[model samples]
Target: MRAFIGMDFDKGLKDELNGIQKVLKINSKKGNWVPSSNFHITLKFLGDISEEQVDAIDRIIKSAVVNTSPLSITLDKLGYFNIRSNQYGVIWIGIKGEMMKLNAIYGIIEKEMKVIGFPKEKRKLTPHITLGRRVILDLPFSQLREQVDHELGKEFLLDNLTLMKSEEIMRKRVYTPIKSYKFNKILEKNHR
Candidate 1:
């Protein structure tokens, strides 16, 4: 199955993201907007994997999150990766807060996944939640960017990391959780 590891957001965050997407949809000429139910922050994309590989990845997740506390993250800004000479792009929302902890979790998972034969990720992690793909704005990107407010939003905790399976069902992409690994150990108060 096609799979990945990611963090799911609470309903509140999903609602907030939906609101943002609604605004984006109004300003976009055309794009494949991500469904609110599909909103998540991908920690790693594992692509296609067999049942045996899923089992191995389960172990990796268990070890990676050991002694890790819940992560607190907030929305930082709206951003995009230009895909076709700036004519089209993938629109995304930037993330911030508890980034060090987020990176450490990713590092542990990446290192151990490599030991299990997965290739090392070529790009450094830039945490963001994808909002849309093949996106073309109604106005110039520079104008849209300057018009939007960029700042902190409500903070939320990612208490667990989920292993997600992706499938195209009835022409819509759906992500289902295969398993979730909770952060079993909390940091001492002094560590904060």
Candidate 2:
């Protein structure tokens, strides 16, 4: 199965992101806007693993996350990926507050998975919630960045991480949740 690990936003955050998407759509083409339901911050992408590995994958995730506390992420800034030209593969918001802790958790997952035989990703980790794809040319970069920044200044709490499955059906990819792990203990402690 094609799978990845990520943090899922609550419905309220999802709605807020959807609103940002609506505004971004004014200057963006149809293909450039990602469906709101697919919005997530990926921690690890484990591509096409065998069915025999499912149990091991679950164990790895549980072990990695069990001690990690829940993190609160604020979405700020609208951004895109491009080396040259305006070929935006992903439009996303930047993460803040507890980002380092979150990164540490992701590192643990990556380390544990590698120890168990999963291949490591070639790309460096950048935590951001993907807002859209397939961007058009001549984008109003300054305005979009401003809008993202304004929205991100508003804070949101994150309490859960999910293991998701990616499947292809009728030429489009669909994401389904396999399991969800809560960081209740992390949130219960005082933020000193």
Candidate 3:
């Protein structure tokens, strides 16, 4: 199956992201915009794996998240990664807040997955939510960025880590959660 590990956004966060997309749409001439329903923060992208591997992944998630509390993060910056050239690329909203905790959990998952035969990720993780792909702006990026509401500034708890399946249905990308692992509930309650 085509699968990955990710965190689903809460409704409030999704709405905020949607607002950002709307701004981008007004400034950009063309791009494949990500629907708000499809908005998520991908922790790891496991392109394809078998059922047995999925089971191993489950164990990895369970062990990696043990005693882990709900993670808090915020939408802090707007940026893009040049895909083909510097002018056109993937636009994203960068994440910040409680990053040290988030990185620790990500490191555990990366290491454990490698032990199970998955190749280690060479690049350091940059936590961000993709807003669009193959995007070309109508104006200079700095001008377009000024039009976006980049600093969402609201902090939200990431309560669960989900194993997601990706499929193209009716020519649209769809992400379905095969399973979700909730973080430490008692620790979560203590924080609030």
In order, candidate lDDTs are: 0.84, 0.76, 0.85
Extract clashing residue pairs from model 2.
75-152, 76-152
The digit string of per-residue lDDT tens for model 2 on 1-192 reads 899888877788889889888777776654456567777888888888787877777887777667776677777677777624556777777777887888788888888889878777777788888777776634677877765566667788777677899997896678888877767664545432
Candidate 3 Cα outliers beyond 4 Å, as residue runs:
83-87, 186-192
Cα error, residue 61 of model 2, in Å, equals: 1.4
Could you tell me which 10 consecutive residues in candidate 3 have the lowest summed lDDT? 144-153
Give the better candidate number (1 or 3) by TM-score: 3
Question: Best candidate per TM-score, number?
Answer: 3
**Clash number for each model:** 0, 2, 0
Record all residue pairs in model 3 with backbone atoms less than 3 Å apart, i.e. clashing: none
Task: Give the RMSD in angstroms, all C-alphas superposed, for model 2.
Answer: 3.6
lDDT of 1 by residue, 29-128 (tens): 8899899999999989999999989888998888887788798888878888876954567888898999999999999989999999889899999999
1 or 2, which is superior by lDDT?
1
User: What TM-score, computed on C-alpha atoms, does each candidate reach?
Assistant: 0.90, 0.87, 0.91
